[model samples]
Target: MLITSGNSMIQSLADTAFAYGRREGDHDTSIPDLTLHIRNTPTEPLHCIYTLSLSLILQGSKQVAIDDRLRICSAGQSMLTTFDLPVISHVTEATRYHPFIGLVLKLDYGLIAQTCTELNLERPSKDLRYQAISTQDIDTGLCDAMSRLLGLHLTPEYIESLAQLYKKEIVIRLLHGSHGMHLRHLASVGSPSRQIVQIVAWMKQNFAQAIGINELADKAHMSASAFRQHFKALTGSSPLQYLKHLRLQEARDQMLLNGLDASQASGVVGYESPSQFSREYSRLFGLPPQKDIQRLRQA
Candidate 1:
């Protein structure tokens, strides 16, 4: 029962990513939280920061670089990112007819916490943060819950009344899954993830300028060394490594949206050394910035 639904959800999401390829000029695909769409295409390598969102691939495959770690997710697999970290991701293969596809459920932790309290579910102390969620199979409890909630997506009249119920069910399903274990980590009162959340907020608000670790640490209300250790424990990267990813990802925006050259894009993203920027950019994205941008434009 639950196993079957997991299979169905994966197949559905994968089919969606594949549909995106037929649109032409489709970059790496994405399906919003309420809806799922996927398509595949043979595309030049591309990269984007997987903002702390829940992503599940239904078909084809993708490779993701998370700081020092590398992860590959294919059909029937999913990942949840708790912190807003930098990531380099690319679809390995796809085609116009049967593109890669996926489903996304963006978890709102605040909503989950509130629901937990309302439902009389006790949260753990806020001093713990889990690193990763790797689940091999989706259980029956999770599958049925998702199906009912998705059906609700079609009912606007009952949406407001049912939102909290659906959202809470979604969290409960995730909590029961391997990836769902992070609810414990996230609830810890002063946990590294708590600080990481603060840092994530600050970074989003202040990504345009160079930032100091001391400043970030202060935002987390910790000493510099302690902040470094905890940040690495949760995000698997040094402060600078994380910052570099942010800058490079920002440059990707310029290339894809405004059509900027690499040099100009580098300047916009705060790169003083053009050659060094190019190397790191290529290292993360699998191509020189100009070529990738040009390819993106041509496609």
Candidate 2:
């Protein structure tokens, strides 16, 4: 008997994910392809870099603010992003009885390309409204495929073999969803969005180094002004601004996770002056580096 899509089934999947990885921080399970997220209470807005991924909200709701635009997504809705985005997200609704449960599957561009070839799917037209991050309703077919993917946890024997099949099906179902056009544009070779995606990937890796508009434009094969326009359109931030956020976030992680001091972290993240780093860190995080770290530790 196949697992069918229903409220009860979705709830059960959420429960399983929660049980498997119920920590204050993010949880990764034996399933290499997915990450299960559970938040027991409402949280302050968190700023992070969102990769090209699909996030399914199984049990609660959250609000995501990208640039100046805000979107609220609830249970049964999916948040799809085609490229890296800097976002501020908060879990607006959650409680012990009904905790916020979600699953994030990082989309594999290579696998998407393979599926596009196999299905003979043409690249869709670009929509200026598609800002890389968009929300869509979760269709019954997609929910069913995700249920089966989560169900693999119950049967260890088939997990290794059957997980791949369910993952492919989920991607195919996404191709048929409301954000299909944007997804197609992302997977399409030579599309402007795809070109920016490559540039973003490079920027992420070399964020600590100085990068210029002309260099990035050349990488995307676009004129300087056109590259800036397309980059902001797709990522909602100027290229240099995007790099700043990435560096700041990484510095925060260094301080919080790696136990680095402010000056050390600032130097490591490419700041020429520690004072400049402190000011910017305070601007973004609402406190000085040491104070923020202390607050987080106390919390």
Candidate 3:
């Protein structure tokens, strides 16, 4: 009998990930396409970029808040984020004995487009983006596919030969699941959703540069009013709001990773005034930039 709801597969996958991860943070797996995330204790909310990816919880749970919208996902559940979103997220439930473990696969747009063409799938309409960030119970088939993907770690030699195939299988499974429509919309070209994605990519690459709504609207091939509406629909934030978050997040990273002072970081991320940067940083991070970096470093 095929096991659809059994915990054995999920548990084994967790064990494998834990054995490899061993430490208490995110780890890129031996398989280039997968990332292993482990947490031993509950955490404070953190701001980070969530890429277009599928995250499967193998043990414990997580709480993800995007644009103040919250979703809690636990073992046996999968969370799909279809865009690179600025999110506040943390592990809400974990322990040394049963650490929170997740296997995250970054979605490959090219592979998805190829699969859709091979399957003769049509693009989903723009309405699908409203449900882009979703959580649902992992179906048996998906769990089984994930188990197989994880097994490749045991035989490193097979990674080059089989990882891509398994990843493709996983994508195919996702395309048939509840969040399939969202993924389909993302892969289709010339749609409003695709235009939003293009605009988002441009913003990501050029967050430090000044941008105007009119320019963004033109890039999206929509009128200013329509662009504002569709941008919010796709990202849950207006274009400027999204750009603000992107700049602030990058500023934080600069402080944390590059050891830049708040003033320096602010200027680097295109904030014209240090005082304004501090205020916005405190508003988003719940602490001033200096203190937040100090706390982060100590932790």
Whole-model lDDT values for every prediction: 0.66, 0.84, 0.86
Candidate 1, residue 38: how far the Cα is off, in Å: 1.3
lDDT of 1 by residue, 1-299 (tens): 33532476645533334443435333432222544545546444455555555665655667777666788776566667766766666777556555666556667768756655565554554553466433345555655555555555456567678766876776876665666557656655676777777787677666667889998888889999999988887777887777787888888888789978788888988888889889998987778888877776786
lDDT, candidate 3, 1-299, per-residue tens: 22322478777777777888789998987888689998899998888888888999888889988775889998888999888888889999999987888889888878988998899886776444456588988877888788788778889999999989998998998898877888888888776777888889999999989889999999888999999998887777889999999999999999999999999999998989999999999998899999999999998
Please give, for residues 1-299, the per-residue lDDT of candidate 2 as tens digits: 22222467666667777777777557776667688888889998978888988998887899999899898988878889888898999999989777888999888988887888788887785544655888876777877787788778788799899988888998898887787778888888787888998898898888889778999999999999999998998888899889899999999999999999999999888999999999998988889999998987886
- Number of clashing residue pairs in every model? 34, 0, 0
The candidates, ranked best first by lDDT, are: 3, 2, 1
Model 1 vs truth, CA RMSD: 4.0
Residue 79, model 1: lDDT of: 66
Q: What is the TM-score of each candidate against the true structure?
A: 0.78, 0.93, 0.94
Name the better of 1 and 2 by TM-score.
2
